[model samples]
Target: MGLFILCFLTTGGALDYLYFDAFTPSGPTLPAATLFSLGAASMITLAAYHGGGSLILGSLGAERPDTQIPEHRELRNIVTEMALASGAAMPQVYVIYDPAPNALATGTNDKNSAICVTTGLLALLDREETQGVVAHEMSHIRNEDILLMTMVSILLGGIAILADLGRRGFYSPRAGQRLGRKTPLLLLPLSLLIGLAPLIGRILSMAVSRQREYLADATAAQYTRNPVGLARALEKIRDAAIPFRGATRGTAHLFFTSPLRRRLENSDSRLAHLLTTHPPINRRIELLYRMAGIMRPPVQNTRNASTRSA
Candidate 1:
């Protein structure tokens, strides 16, 4: 929904400026504006949701599981079991060669989805914990979180890119002529909006990511019938203390936990909390423990452990 609205706003804003310059001094005809806004927004939404998954996978160096290997076969089987439990179609599976204990899901919808896990995830977690992580990723597919997140990430990047271009265009001599001297007022407001859209879009996207992560965690507990499994998996992940070599802040929100090591691990400041893509690790573990009818206190030094072997 936020993605759709941002798309409409950015596209509509562009159209309005074009129409104002080309067709009428006032603005484009209402009917034309409406039609163009809807059309552009629809196209962008589809492109972001449908094509964005492959872009993400490629950027992260994820590849289809090498099914001939016993370990790859086991991973595929786990994904299939979780998908069946969730009543979602089996999704394509990928393996990230990185030695970080993390996994993420992608694709536009359940039928089109893919799941990728790091080699370290498979190496470090035992069967039950691996199942728990797979269940968590499957829950994201079942709830359509992958589609929303992939689209949001693309849209946020688009907002930033377009805003930069708009700023450059605004300062051009052609732009000065396009908006007459009397319309300098219009230029100021438009420029400010274009500059701010990226920052605003990023904050909103991060908030959405956090909320969806919480929901996916709960759904994973339901699907696995074992919140403790996920809780332990998270503990193992936290204890590893290794940064995901492939992770950038752009795709951090997609992972089972924040993929960067110690980036925001100890910050409890309100601003840091709000900017984080995932809820605090221990907080997430506590919620899972609650689901399992346990009330364990958060361990204070979960992030201090040495990096685990892959």
Candidate 2:
């Protein structure tokens, strides 16, 4: 959150210098303009922070699961069970109509949270696996991972918006000459920072997301006492051929796995690893197996023996 605020402030400062200070000859003094810009940016940030959950759900087209439907009923049941197990309030349950198997938790806190699953997740996983998946999401809600990720996402969006504004203002015919004249010493560095802010914010978001995923996995195992179930669900998600059509880079980190069909996650290179939102599926599975005190199972009957043991 601190990092996100810093990026937002940096971008906001650049905008103030480029447009607020440069364009208005009789405007407020430089310090006053800067203060005003920062204050405005802070208000926007707080609003986005508080409302991020609804924004994410709306962006993903998440809808309340119809309890009249059997599958949706079962999904809600599993969510309720997990909620009780985690000592959290019953979160609103939602479903996405995508074919890709994925799930996410969102909201500011446990009482105000939601859990959404793809249609494919319901079709693909049996009751036990579904419980594991729901448990994972529930863990995110309980641990405040939902709040953290939502805020990061909002900040990332803010940085991208401010960066675009800075970029356009710097290159504009009138603003460019004025900016060059007003603060030539700061121009080059500020331009570079604005240009790179989005990438930098994305990297930071991914890094934080990856670590939270591991924590959620462990917490889920604790909640379910069945790490193999989540491990199996993850394996199915990893091998599923269909990608989520609705997923975008901006919302990719919120899912149980990366929803975008990118091969970068499979590479062994350090940079590729750094850029991914989730840790490697195999590594996560191995960690789960370690938690369960069992040897990793073979592919064909991975669930049978491990499920029994767990």
Candidate 3:
């Protein structure tokens, strides 16, 4: 939240400078513009949380399971068991009819929460692996990670919107010379600052998101007492390399894996990783294996005989 506020303030400051120095002579000065920007940011954040669940699911084309079939019943049962284990309400479950294997949890609170998974996930994962994925999402609900991610997403959107508006208004052919004509000394610095605000904010947001994912992984392991299940689920997701068709930059953070192209995970660039919401799959699997007191899972199901210790 601090990062969100800081990014908002920085972007607001740039916008204020642009208005006073370039856009309109009578435009809201620094103080008034700041207030307006703050109000806008507040509205965006409130709307995000107000009907956030519906907005998220609707954006992803998610549908409530018909619940008439045996398979759907089993899916609901897994959710019920995980919700019990995580001490959260049995959140409404929805299905996305995509070929990508992924899932997410969202709501303003535990009682209002919903979990959505793709058809691909159901087709790909075994019972234990499915339990692990469900447990990981439930952990997000337990930790209110959904709320945190939603907040970040709103702020990121605000920053991007503000930055884009500032750039277009400042750089348009008619106004491109406005800054230079009026404030020769400030044009370059201001332009650079305004341009970089969105990128910087996105990077910080993704870094925080990656950390939360690690914590969720740990918590899921604790709840299920079977880190290997999630480990295997993640491995499968990595190998499948199918992107969720419905995911966009706005909702990508909600997914268990990156919903962008498979090549995103393949990038070895340090800068590329910072902009991604998830840590590398292999690193996550290694941590889960460590949590399970095994360096790595054996070729076979050696851990299958071990039950989840109460």
Which structure among the candidates has the greatest lDDT? 2
The lDDT for every candidate, in the order shown, is 0.78, 0.81, 0.79
lDDT of 3 by residue, 1-310 (tens): 7777767766667666665552456554445556666887788789878876787788789998878865567789999999999888889999988889999998878988998888899989998999999998999999999887876777777888878887878657667554655565666777776798877877787787788889899999988899999999987887777888888776677888888854455454796687787876667888898888888742322222232232
**In angstroms, how far off is 73's CA in candidate 1?**
2.0
Off by over 4 Å in 2: 19-28, 31-37, 182-185, 297-310
Which residue pairs of candidate 3 clash? Answer: none
Which stretches of candidate 1 lie above 4 Å from their native place? 2-4, 7-40, 170-189, 265-269, 302-310
TM-score for each model: 0.83, 0.88, 0.87
**How does model 3 fare in lDDT?**
0.79
- Ranked candidates, highest lDDT first: 2, 3, 1
Range of the 10 consecutive residues with the lowest summed lDDT in candidate 2: 298-307
By TM-score, who's the top model here?
2
lDDT of 1 by residue, 112-161 (tens): 89999999999999888999999999999988889888887666665666
TM-score of 1: 0.83
Model 1, residue 271: what's the lDDT?
A: 78
Clashes of each: 0, 0, 0
